[model samples]
Target: MTRTLRVFRWSPGEAERTREYRVEAARDTTVLDALVEVQRSQDPTLAFRYACRVGMCGSCAVVVNGRERWACRTRLGDLGAGAVRVRPLYHFPLLRDLVVDLGPHAERLRRALGAFTPRAGAEPYARIAGDSRERAAIDEAIECIGCGMCVSACTLVAPNPRFPGPAALNRALTLQLDSRDGAGAARWGVLLGEDALARCHGQGTCTEVCPMGLQPTASIIRLRWLGLSRLLRWTG
Candidate 1:
């Protein structure tokens, strides 16, 4: 059985026209597989990025049939119809077909001081109890692959790129709950600033789109609660 792919493509530095590629595919082939065929057989200039075809890397995220998904995991049959629409992730600078530059997202994660930084009397990484509340909190959020599917779903990131989005805030939340991290106050300060936590509108689409089954909306909710707590404490 042959399937047809309706791939949305726009070459970099070419904004005047968008290119559509219709290609034949096998029933067992995924959209990413069909895309590779189109690129290899006809257009060598097509650009996208993927490291693992097994969906572990999370680098193959694309908009297929109006939903954000891991291309490697999305089979042709999953699309059902003969046509599957493929495009770059939304709310970011499109680098090319099915690819968006995530530099700004990376920068925001850095600004949050994403990794663990300890206080003077903090226990060693090995000393931290596996079943501790902070450990459990961080464990749940640690599965994120930074695929930006949540970013694509977020309406706020469209208007405000400064908002940390789900991935970064999830990263921040993980660190905030770390038992050894002396940086909670500092992390919250950056995350709660005008351009950061204050900007989330709670659309909850980020939770809906995450492939890892993580609830970033919950993290953002916790963040909002923390921010309000701090405000109350300060005002008192």
Candidate 2:
């Protein structure tokens, strides 16, 4: 069967336009596969990034039919039959046809102090129990692939560029729970900044669009609770 792909095409300082290409593909063909076919036979100038063709790399993410998804995992069968509208992930600066700049999101993660710092006298991981509370608390957050999907789906990031967005907050939550982490105070300071977690309106868009099944909204709520507790302690 044949399908039409209306892909967004643009570059730095270039007028944006949508180019439609029709290709033959099976219903089971992945969007990435179809794109590869289009590039091979249709347009050689099309630009997009994909590493693992499986869902692990998180590099082939795009806005498909008004939703953010990994092209490798999203099957043409699932989209039904029609022109598939493909665009770069929203809430990010478009670099080209289907690529967006992820550097901003990475910068936010860095500003959030999303690194781990072991506390004094902390035992090595070999000595720490696998089922310990600290490990359990961060298990889900560690599953994030840094795809920037959460950041793109986040409503706050579009309006408030300074908001750290879900991915960064999720990273902060993981580090915040680390009993060995000695940067809790500093991390909290960043999360409590005027343009940080408080700007999150609990839209849950980030959680819904997360392909990793991670609940970033829940993490933000937990961070809010932690922030409140700290405020109370400071006041008392």
Candidate 3:
């Protein structure tokens, strides 16, 4: 079977354009597979990014048919019989066709203090009970692969670049809930900033487009609530 892919194309200093390519497709063929075939047999100059094509790496994420999806995981058969529209993830600098710079995303994570800070004199190998509240709080959010889909779908980052985005805020959520992490007030300070958690309009676009089934909107809400509780206790 043959399928048509309308892919976004551009280069540094080149006018952006969409190029269509026809490739042989099988029932099990994925968007990634189709792209590889196109690059190999159709257009060798085409560029994209992918690693661990099994969907664990989250590197091959692209906008497919107007929604963010992992190209490797999205099977051609799953999409109706129409041209598959492939484009780069939005809200980031485009490097080339179907590839965007993730540096801004990483910067937001850094601003959110996404790294874990060990508590002073804490146990070297402390174990958290599976049923503990801290464990439950982050269980659903810890699997994020940093694919930038949520960031691309988020509406706030474009207008206010200072907003630490869904991915960064989601990372902060996991670390904030960690009892062993000593970031404490320092982390909260960033989350409470006007451009950080407060900028989230609760649109849920981030949650809707997340490839990992993570609820970054909910994570932001949880962080907001945590910040409020801290404020109340401090005042009391």
Candidate 4:
């Protein structure tokens, strides 16, 4: 089937341009398949990122037609339209067509200074009791595959670049509940900042776009409660 792909093109070399591309794509083909056909058969300069097109990699994510989803997982036939619009992640730096530079976000998580800090060089590992509240908290968002579909759909990140967004905050929530994770002030420090949980407006866009069904807004709320508790304790 011949369909037009409304591709958003941009790079450091070119001033950013949007062009519609008509390509012959098979029915029931995924958006990734259509993009692959366009790149290999149509335009060599087009750029997008994908690996393990089975939706496990989370690299083929893009804003398609207006919704944030994984291209590899989204079927083109599912879209009732003559054209499919593809754009880079809303909040990240545009590297090129459909590809956004996620390095900064990734880097921030690595430097978050939590989950790595042990408590006073204490016992080998902090024991996590099966029925403990912290243990249950970790289980809430531990299934995140890091596909970032939620982050792309997040309105907070789109308007506030400093917001650590859903991914990092989710990670923090996982650690916050981890009894073994010796993160005290460090975890709250990173999670409560502007780029962290505080920036979330509870719009629930992240949860809606999450393919894994993880609730980020819930995690943020938990973090808020944890922060308030911590602050109250410190003052008292």
Candidate 5:
């Protein structure tokens, strides 16, 4: 059961380094469990983040073997007997080993007008039909759990900081599609900005790495089409 875990080690005001830990773990054990074991038995200073170890909270996301995954849900057995390399999610400020600051991602969402604003004077008990288009649209884009995996997987964020990443754009799409949301046109306007939706470039990495099964690529395409249609209407 002995395994070699190469964990990225860093702290504020220090150069980043990789520290390898030898730990005994079962084959079915998750990477997060192995990390916890390493921290408990070998090194107490190892820093990582996890909540709801059953994978619901999405806080345990890390880069394992060069791909983003939920550390809590990724089994060592699935990796097939190779050294495991764990690092914080990419494209965010690394706080320490396997932990990154999510503040910038949240702020990007805020700048993109991702919040839901209810329509003025809308009835509190408005009934939405199960088969309605708005209901379907909302359901399509509302499942993001804010794991920041999509943001890490998106390469566009590296050069274009203003690009609101997949999660924020997905949130904007959900709000844009909701009939009850008051920020519909304004949200679209924000998304149409130079550093916003057009920067996505139709890369499927976000969709591929999303643990929640959300298709951010498709959402971006839909939003762009809507934005273009609106622009045409205005110009015509």
Candidate 6:
């Protein structure tokens, strides 16, 4: 079967435009596969990113038909015979065709102290209980692949660019619940900042778009409750 892919294209100084390419697709043909065919045969200039075609790397994430999805995992047959509209993830600077600069997403993670800071001078190979509350709290959220889809889907990001997006906040929650993480007060300071946890409106769009099925909205809510409890303990 033939499918039309309406892909967004742009260069450094070029005006943004959508270019359509028709490609032969099988039931198992993925958006990434079609894109590869387009780049190989249809248009050599078409640009996009994909590392692991099996969807583990999260590098192939893009906006598909108005939703964030991993192009490598999106089957053309699943799109229901409509022209597949492919665009770079929203809330990010467009770098080129189907590629967006991920620097902002990284910066947000950095600002949220997303990196795990081990307890200083702690013993190597410290073990955590598998059934502990901390482990349970982060089990679902710990698998985040750092794809910028949640950030792109977040409604608060465009209006408030300072907000450390859902992915970052979700990472923060994981670290905050980690018994081995020494970020502690410093991490909490960032989490409770004017543009951090409070900025999240709990819209769940992040949860909806997360390619990893992580619940960032629930993480944010957990962080909010933890923050409030910490504050009350200090005052009580």
What total of clashing residue pairs does each candidate reach?
0, 0, 0, 1, 0, 0
Q: Compared with the true structure, what per-residue lDDT tens digits does model 3 show for residues 123-234?
A: 9888789998879879999999899999889888899989999999999989998989999779999999889989999999999988778999999999999999999999
lDDT of 1 by residue, 90-124 (tens): 88787777678988778768877877787777656
- Worst 10-residue lDDT window for candidate 2 reads 120-129
TM-score of each: 0.89, 0.95, 0.96, 0.87, 0.96, 0.97
CA lDDT, every prediction? 0.80, 0.89, 0.93, 0.79, 0.89, 0.92
- How high a TM-score does candidate 2 get? 0.95
Off by over 4 Å in 5: none
For 69-136, candidate 2 gives per-residue lDDT tens digits of: 99999998899778999999998888899999999988888889987787767776633467987788
Q: In candidate 5, what are the lDDT values of residues 149-209, reduced to their tens digit? A: 9999998999988889999998888888877878887787788888898788887999999
C-alpha lDDT (0 to 100) for residue 58 of candidate 5: 96
Q: How many angstroms is residue 83 displaced in model 3 relative to the true structure, after the best TM-score fit?
A: 1.2
Query: All candidates: CA RMSD in angstroms?
Result: 2.1, 1.4, 1.2, 2.5, 1.2, 1.1
lDDT of 6 by residue, 50-76 (tens): 998998999999999999999999999
Off by over 4 Å in 1: 16-18, 121-127
Error of 4 at 171 (Å): 0.8
Q: Give model 3's TM-score versus the native structure.
A: 0.96
> Model 3: which residue pairs collide?
none
Error of 2 at 27 (Å): 2.0
Model 2: CA > 4 A from native = 121-128
